[model samples]
Target: MFTPSYHDGVIQHLITDVSEDDFNVAVGGQVEIIGWLYQYYNTEPKDRAFKKKKYLESDIPAVTQLFTPDWIVKYMVENSLGRYWIDVLQAKEDPRSSREIAEDFGWQYFMPEAEQSDQISVQTNADSLSQADIEDVTLIDAAMGSGHILIYAFEVFMQIYEREGYSRRDAAKLIVQKNIYGLDIDTRAFQLAYFSLMMKARGANRRFLTLDIRPNVFDVPESGELTSADFQELLQSEDEAKQLDYLLDQFRYGNEYGSLIQLDKSVDWSMITRISNQELDEGQLSLSSIVLTESQDKLREICAVGKILSRQFTIGAMNPPYMGSGKMDSILGKYVKKHFPNSKSDLFAVFMERLRSLTDTNGYYAMITQHAWMFLSSFEKLRSVLKADTLINMAHLGTRAFEEIGGEVVQSTTFVFKHQTIANYIGTYERLVNFDSQQKKEQAYLAAVKNTDVDYLYRTNQANFAKIPGMPIAYWASANLIHDFEVGTRMDELVDAKVGLQTGDNSKFLRIWYEVDNKKISFRSVNLSESVKSQKKWFPCNKGGAYRKWFGNYDYVINWKNDGHEIKNFNWPNGKQRSVVRNPSYYFREAITWSDITSGSFSLRYREPGSIHDHKGMSAFSKDHELLIMILAILNTPVGDHIFKILNPTVSLEVGNFKSFPVIKNKTIEDKSFNISRKLVQYCKEDWNTFETSWDFTSHPLLTHIADDNLSHCRSPVG
Candidate 1:
């Protein structure tokens, strides 16, 4: 018997208040309300609830669940599923025309270069498959958080069936029974998904519910299915543990071959059908459920659910969860590392591997996930694995891709990669960056879908990527530039690259220029350069400040009087050091420093003697001052910034990324570079001293000169 417990038990509560005219609208509204409630409960204090759990373990699904917007769902479904159907239809014709192509796919065909390829319509020989063969195509949403993607895919499958002369009612039933599959780790999500899919069928035929509809949706593992007694019994028996492991292996194999085999009497349903109570007492294992009944009915239901998920999909779509391995529990982290070492940096990366494996040959896998894998050094191995497949298209959206999420959320990118490794395939990459808001980001995304000519869009071969030092998806690099990376020497070879000290507690040990008691921020009752009678507390510190170049960002003083004893002893509540002090020997040494975080290019500034640099600005020290200035000149150039963008795409300027900078080791070139850099620094210093903000300045340059047309065009802001 089919145990459809979720639809009647949990789903009814979710859609109770959702009474709208349109089906999609009603579902969307319910989801919005559900999401809002989840957010509220997740953020609220649990202490006020009278010693309840600080946060319910069950609420994790709601807290993390992000609704896939309607437009994005359509974009994903159409490109993966819709494109498949279009290719099939095109194959039925003897000769395909641009006009027919324009009429049929003009709205979706954005890549003009790919449009020119005659093979664009010829995805596979299977395109000429009969209607019956097309019906066998399986599509799954691996993460299926409320079944939004699967629901839209249901509508598309209905259209395909309808085109093959099936009525809407029959099409809906067939689509649910054969075409769609969904899996989610969250039971609440599975419940919503099941309810939403059932409602989709109900929308077509009111009498559809009266007939049995086995919607191919299952909650992964169904943690609540087995009782504590059942688990304890299994734990006690080594034979039962081995049997369970074998069952899991069979389940995995079934996913790959389930659809290929017919589910008939030839298969042994005996394990599911026949269960004896004696086996439990005798320490023998069987599929009988301890919680439900000692019969095959419950076992059969679980087996059926397992049968659905054990099949591979022709098309997969999802917005997988965005969590990193660092946030996972130790057990989960260990399992992920062991299973998915190549993509273990983040949960989404692991899903990318899982989704790809779930797809059959020539199948399309499309997802919107954190974009870090494309460029981060840690994910280089994962990128290599992706390079083995065919990249269909990508929409790389920078930070603030999601609404109401800011400050330091992972940036997002939407991409579709096929399981095939076609060498000549050219993928379209639309780089949508610097959008002011989530609304603008969506608008920009839709523009890409419709094939509007916009900036930051390019079409490149997959072979061009993952070839550089850090394996950056250098979609923006020219042919000449890519060649340069292959032959260039890295910067760390020339200079001694080192990050500065981390004071641990800046407020206690450091103070701004204004916060100091004297002209400088001074510690009370402390002596400076010479030894003090009382104590020594204040010292000039070179913490990285604003982005002005050569001379003036000296804005703080640090208390390193006793060799940073207080900071070194400080510990956080987590038992970790509150502050990290590295390379203390390099303190008060002349070096070139730059802000670790900046809005624009990484600006290298010079630091004078008697100043300790902080972690905010990493310092590059050289015994030779001329060599340091040369490195500074190289870093300040547009070429240096362009390379930095390739090494580390994000705003963070890590020493690791800086170490990869290509340097020229020729003495002649170094001398010339040093001379030019010295002149530039002198000019910047002169400009700095001219301003009243400079400690040495007497008057402002603008006050000394009368205003003119030249001054009007280049006016500076007044305080």
Candidate 2:
């Protein structure tokens, strides 16, 4: 028999140092140690696959399996499984009594208010349920990873089992057999998850060490040569093919039911062992020989694997892996596109869709995932679906939420939702933002858990999200702002907003005026309405510059020699254009432009008619100059900035972000805004004209004084 006491090199050091007793209490830390080890090993694999534009099959689990912190796991379980019991208790509580009374009666293990009301339908007049009913509830973690969720759930199940008067040993065995279930794609992750749950059970009842008990954690079986050959042989024989067909149908059921395969509830261990022993001598692979176990021990493992197959869980909790569509392998990318067409932009979004399939009716699921799905336009359909569900609670844990993940790697949000969709569900949303360091983030999280009064933490309703165009779950948007989204018209209708031209090679096609010798070529920045060119090699280009409003950022020029024909026609040896030209009509058209990358705030400046715009800046154009000025004024205002931030939570703002913002066009307001913008533009124009850059000037006033020295011709103003 192969003992369960085996450690891979990745976690050998940590596993060897920890005794069984230490491992039980420190399971959370052990999970973290393994998570870091996995991350360390896959760093190179991730980089290699990214460089090669392929996903390394070997590292899929390693790349995705993150050790969800104990607190997050607890929050998910408490809100999900704990809420299920609370729902039963609430339904049984007196209609006139407060929820606090239900908690006081030990009917509710976790606070009801902490989760969404849609999870449980409460009736004060309903019949009371016994403790045995609580133990009957089942739970699973779809992406179980190191089984932290299941391990913690085991603790919760033990509490329920004990409360029902079951012995510790019996409760431990029952919890593994009936309550906890898990599935992970990675075999290594499945092993850790299975071991973690076993350890958890052993802690509850040390007698568990003597029994041939197995935790209901399973992995997708790798198709090997032996299994393939066996299947082929079975298909060739009519009698064997019938058995194969039954098994295949059961496998399909297993997938639909939550198990990776149809697990045999009853196993003839003695016969299985005999067959295994026979197969090994014949140089064939068998389950018993593969695991190197015999008798009831191997049968228990087999039975445990089946327990999760074709089973529905009452609760699901996971911190699903994060991978953007750009990083995904073509196979997974296509699968996501086919199944979850709306949220296929990111792998995390796809997992959000996948999570919906893992729970039973009225089952609750809780996850901490990227907050982008809550607002991005690509996930608009996803939001529409999720909003209909009973969103129990949301904690918007924006950037720097994870300590081990250095810097502001992911802006995260943790939420709990029930499987059922209730029309009148009210969910609580808590905002936790502006944490500069990891310590601050941790402190804020602790305070939120304690339900303490933290200044940054505030609450909102789930219904408020529906008013927004994308149904953005903007928990922080005030009631007034929500109303604005409902009433105002989107800006795309009022202006021609778009990204500018792409000079495929900036180094070859563009230059600062000082970088090249001055000679009349084909470039000039003059009124394009009338044909004009400066007698210089470089013509002005609007490549985005510093944060100044109204005007400026005209320091660049593209070599438009031969009227841009040579630059436009340039191509590489592969027959791909070395230079790209877009929006030819928009070029040299007077417009308002802004840099795509901003310092958390937006600044828009005017680009004159003679300038060619570059991709670094996006532009909004209109023949109605006054209207464009009015739009510019609105964008610079506090309201515009607020809307932009809500539409795009990230620092990077694209043209789509601009289009999403609502335009409040009141003629009276537009007239005044236009006047302010016109004045600002003129002031900026004078500032530009004051310098030697003014093309109309023969020579700089200061230089004129030094060259002439004619006291009479000192009409030049110099102090």
Among the numbered candidates, top TM-score falls to 2
| Model 1 regions lying over 4 Å from their true place | 1-56, 86-132, 221-241, 245-311, 406-410, 434-455, 513-542, 561-563, 569-579, 663-676, 683-719
Full-model lDDT for every candidate: 0.67, 0.66
| Tens digit of per-residue lDDT, candidate 2, span 439-495 | 675556656645635555555667777777667787778888888777888888887
Clashing pairs in 1: 254-310, 255-310, 255-311, 504-579, 516-521
lDDT of 1 by residue, 1-719 (tens): 12356466445644565455233443444444443444344344322332433223343354446776656676678777776555566566626543354345433432322543656435565543423256688898877877878887887787678767899898888888888988776666678788878877888878889988779887764223333244444244555444433443343422222221122222233333333122445454545534434432334544665555455788988888765665555545666687689998887888888788878777788898888887777788998888878887777777777665676446788878878887667777878767766677667766765564677678777787755676677787777777776677777776767887786778788876556555333323222233133245666777788887866676777766566667787899998888888887677777888888876777887776557778887778777888889888888888888888878777677787787777756888778888988988888877887865555576567755756665654556765
Give the TM-score comparing model 1 with the true structure, all chains together.
Answer: 0.76
